[model samples]
Target: MTMAQRIGFGTQIRKSPFFDATLRWGATGFSVYNHMYIPRDFGDPVQNYWNLVTAAILCDVAVERQIEITGPDAAQFVQMLTPRDLSQMAVGQCKYVLITNTEGGILNDPIVLRLGKDHFWFSLADSDILLWAQGLAVHSGLDVTICEPDVSPLQLQGPRSGEVMKALFGDSILDLRYFWLRELDLDGIPLVVSRTGWSSELGYELYLCDGTRGDDLWEKIMAAGAPFGLQPGHTSTIRRIEAGLLSYHADMDADTNPYELGLGRLVDLDTDFIGKAALARIRDQGIRRKQVGLVIDGPPLSGPNTVFWTVKKDGASIGTVTSAVYSPRLDQNIALALIAAEHAVLGDRVDILVDDQPARARIVDRPFYDPKKTRPKAELKAG
Candidate 1:
């Protein structure tokens, strides 16, 4: 394709620094997220999932943009954005947090990195949190500067990711604890390496601090991982569903509350936040819908469902299946669904319309792969 043909998608949508690198390395399809082009395809998704679990895969996740918050009142201003307690979050630590609205509805679920005493970066899922923060700062009597920094991230995830990291950053990278981060210099290539990722596997997110070095960063990591069987891949939907990770707009959105997803642990009612009062009311009254796991009874799904499948208990519709996939390892069709609280009992069976064809499923436990997360938490001692 010529440059004009390649660039015909319009310049309004931003491209990541690793955009060109991704296409060269086998990225076949793309999707839009946070107004940026995100690589969604790099061959068969099932093969991508296997490549991730068995070995390692390098994913260009620059679309997971960072919203940088800094200033004297930064900490306080950040606290107002979510119900999660940030008082005990030490510097260089990472915490998975839910950004909520005043109505106690979830805005986005992001992993926040505490860079300094008053500096933080919200590694977002897929929403405009930068605009939200800037808007909040205008009226809230807080002195905080909110802006989008020139940062892009790549995910090097799988069982052998540590070996890949050690090859690139040496033994010191092993000491980097899970959910913690440290800034590192890779031959003068700026980065903030963190032991965190969306996949429930031992992995690291390499945040490229300089946009100009995107190509260099991608090539260096791939070269180091080549000996370890690393393949260029996209985030795995089958694996993520097995891990029970919530997608921002899919599983829960602006209308979904924290309690419904069994994520009340992230909320601190004692501390005042944007949605404390509304959440307290929810806590008192109880939630209407609840998130649950399901084992759909049928043949293996051809692929992950693209739309919400209607879930019905008996003859009446109760909820909808947000995410569903066929786990090759488990040999079962697993799904995450949201249904009325009264009908969400374990072992209860429900009917679902899979492409308008009737199907049956039973309520089951989620994170079907690793509910305890023992794999991701396992130490990275050199072999």
Candidate 2:
């Protein structure tokens, strides 16, 4: 029998609805995100990566707090949050957007879903956008109700995720287009199912509307997916790095602007937003630093970097390695870094202080693997 894990923390930290279910399913480790305990370990992370890419894994990402905005003025109020052109956003469509501060710095990156003409939900990353949105609504003349609902999200990701989804909801689930959401019911459990996931694989995220049904929802998914080799797993850092996906607070934070991260595509200057003037000025002035990919010349990284490793070029500090990890598929240590734009040349050699030891590295493309994202956005076969 496995030894019982004891956790010591104050009541301030919240627990997800699937906490008990995950613990019963062999989740042995946890990490705090958005003031909630998230399962980060279920054994070997490398094995978890293989499971996510080869088969499928169910992740309790309940920490992705849903900030619901609904009111007569919700449509106009939502547009003031991000620079993205939501004018053409249709009901049931989801958009990945950035919430910025007055300085144009990213406050939080959330996926906004248009549930109705004036109803929306901002499924957030690590930061607290609920407070930000609520605080903003206090003074704005817009009529909107901003609050956190009883919703929690679970990611069912991998190449085989489709097959598993079909088994659960029938073949109709396969027709759901990418980045779109539909209200669904499974055995009396109310949910908002979306053809979206963070794994950069063909996957789905099931948003449990009722928190009380967490255990029931988790068990149902696992049972339905057992035939397809489904495993209880955490989000894979390796696959995310390989896909060139960014992690908030690691790859970016409140101080990081969209242009510096090459995410200017998410910023639409033509639209009026909270930080439009600041972003416009930054765009005209050009960015001083840029985020890039690097191939660290060393043994495979044991795990993700815990600190910002210093990057130097010709004995001068140029930038810092934000996030670094070994990609088992690539068989190399790849990293994402923010460095001076002048030193961001591809194929340029730089030295990074890994664990206080000097290691040689070369500038490479952002994504070490699929550049065009063909895997996640691949078209499904018609019947």
TM-score of each: 0.97, 0.97
Name the regions of candidate 1 deviating beyond 4 angstroms: 1-8
lDDT score, candidate 2, position 175: 87
Tell me how far the alpha carbon of residue 58 in candidate 1 is from the true structure, in angstroms, after superposition. 0.5
State the C-alpha lDDT per candidate.
0.94, 0.93
lDDT of 1 at 79: 90
Q: How would you encode candidate 1's per-residue C-alpha lDDT over 1-383 as one tens digit per residue?
A: 77634754678789999999999999988888998999999989889999999999999999999999999999999899989999999999999999999889999999999999999999998888889889989999998999999999999999999999999999989999999999999999999999999899999999999999999999999999999999999999999999999998999998999999999999999887898899999999999999999999999999999999999986999999999999998899999999999999999999999989999999987778788999888798865
Clashes of 1: 0
What's the TM for model 2? 0.97
Give residue 74's error in model 2 in angstroms: 0.5
Alpha carbon deviation, residue 167, candidate 2 (Å): 0.6
CA RMSD per model (angstroms): 2.2, 1.9
